[model samples]
Target: MARLFNRTTQQGSRTSLPMATTLPMTLFMALQSRKTRYRSTLVVLAVLLCLSTYLLARSSSSASHTLLHKDMPSDDQMPVVFEEASHSHVSGTARKHRKVHKDREQVTLDPSQELAAISSFLASLPQNVIPLSVDPSVTVDPQLVLDFDTRSPRAAAEVQHMVADVWLRNPVFLYSKLYSPASREVKAMLAKMDLRPAPTIIDVDIRDDAEVLEPIIKRLSSSSDLPVLLIGGKPVGSMKEIRLLDKSGELRKLVAASGAVVDGSKKKQHKH
Candidate 1:
């Protein structure tokens, strides 16, 4: 109403009697109820204040997020300035393609030095004795079968040497195992050493001595041109014995009596 009156006044308008008179009374009554009106307005104002506070908090949070995430300057303006600064930090480096040369080594050997070295090595070992404990009548075949297991330490070592020797001369010589264990080692023993005189020997250990002895005797007597020397009551094979006799002296008469060539003074005495 005051605004209305002020507008009216500004327009230079005159108020009529009825409006002029009623306006004062209405204004007076409104003024008298001003406390009640003010209280109702205060309640509405408080609700509006709460709504404003919520809007302000929301706006503040939105502004904070925008400030946190975005560049500080306005969108239309340059956001940041940059400068290419010199970074002259000191550093050390190593190269990979490096070459190194090594000198040639010298090899030297002296007769005295070699002799001393051999003597030293030989001195470390005990005497090499071919353990001659096995029986010679075990088997006629090179495959030595005895009453002893060849796996025993003494037997294995001896047999290893014997088999090696057998192969060294007659590679056809073979080996076999025994089913039982006895004092005899089959490897060191032979049916007839006179065939091949092996220094590494196994003595006779035949269970049935006669059975073994008879066969050897028969082989000897069956041949007219063969004479075998029986040593230790065991008949030796003339196949090996004859070759040995040719190399030794006394065996020439036996070699001649058999009507075989006496490879002794007779061989030299006979004309070509």
Candidate 2:
């Protein structure tokens, strides 16, 4: 029996040069019990790797998309890409989007500036009324004349009455109606204003050009010793200077406030 026990202990103690190492009982038992969990973990990891690869391939399909993805700017890096544009530029849709944004920033949105510009444009038209606010405290100089040579039929009549009402009442302000008579249209029209003629009417007919304008200028400048403003060859008044612009009213009011007078007339009477 002692000889049999000695042989059994030697067999158990001897380590063998086996193909695979044998696990201890505790480790072997744990692996055997959790075999299903280990298999499931491996399968899930393989699926995640395959999905990530497929998504990357799908995003790089287009050439532009591929370029955008490569060397992309992160929040911690530069945002703008300013590469020299090759002959091949950005898509037409991208250019149009940039232009639309630029034009929106350039447009002026103020409502009052638009309205004032329109009003000033309309006021410059023929027969458009100008409200003459006279400080009657200013004694009128008889040398300054308001002359009308408007070619429009309605304009001549409208201007005649407008100037007369203001000029005739003043002690020294005077007015005259000067125009061509080649047309019976003008003659028939002038007959309407004379319906209530005052002694203060001075009518001059010019068949020639600004030869008529020259004399009127000479008369006003010689008589008043003041600057004369002409409108289409008719002497309008004594003014320091005339400026032509889209918004003459603002400038005119500025001049008036500074005690300087301005005439909006387009023509300038020749100064001797």
Candidate 3:
């Protein structure tokens, strides 16, 4: 009976040892499977993070490129606009200068036309306005005398003393042929002015005294013209220069300086 009890206890101990070994193996396998699942989850999270970073970087680059393009003007359009503005400014400046030049040209006068106008004015004078001859008997101021060549045509002689009354109250010496359209115009201009004394007229024949007349005319003018005004024993210029001086108000001062009396009242009247 004792032997039977000992055999039964040994069989139970062997069965308990097998059960403990199997439990430890099963627990180790379960731990290994849990570690594998954790590794797979970490790999999937890393991939998602990398994809998200790439997408964010691409979007940022695209936005920067769009902003750059929007801020700057196109190369072709910019140059064309600037060039057109520059050309328009230059053309406007050039046109202004041309207009100013044209205005200056319009105010200028022709020399020939001025001379023709003077001639026309002389032809319109009244026929009855004849200059009186200078009398040798009267004592006259030599400075006031306007000398003329006697050899000129009779028409030239008629106009020599026309302005003598107004320009000089003393006397005018006429050589034959001293009359001309210029002289007539000068005389008519003088006659229109208020003067004190009518100028005395004297006629001298150049044929009789050519030697005396030649020196006088040469001293007064470069050419042997019909009429020459001598003031203070000096030549004043031709009719054109006289007209210029008169218009400028310089002739009155010059004549007054030469001991010729100008009508102050007439000058004031003309100014008004």
Candidate 1 at 269: error in angstroms? 99
The candidate scoring highest on TM-score is: 3
List the candidate 3 regions with Cα displacement exceeding 4 Å.
1-178, 197-215, 219-221, 264-272
User: Distance (Å) between predicted and true CA of 183, model 3?
Assistant: 1.4
Q: Each prediction's TM-score against the native?
A: 0.15, 0.15, 0.29
Off by over 4 Å in 1: 1-32, 71-272
Q: Give the per-residue lDDT of model 1 (tens digit) for 1-272.
A: 99998998866644566677899999889987997889999999999999999999999999999987686555433212322211111011111121111121212223222222212211222231111332323323211221122223244454444433333333112111132222122232323223332222222222223234333334423422212232222233445554465456434444233333323344446665
Tell me the tens digit of each residue's lDDT in model 3 across 1-272.
88998899889999999999999899999999999999999999999999999999999999999999998886532322211212221232111111111111122112222222222222223121111232322322121121221122331333334333323333222222334576666565555443333322222232333344333444334545545554432445776887897788776666566554467567668889
For each candidate, what is the lDDT?
Answer: 0.35, 0.33, 0.43
lDDT of 2 by residue, 79-101 (tens): 22223212111222011111111
* Candidate 1 lDDT for residue 214: 33
Candidate 1 achieves a global lDDT of 0.35
Candidate ranking under lDDT, highest first, comes to 3, 1, 2
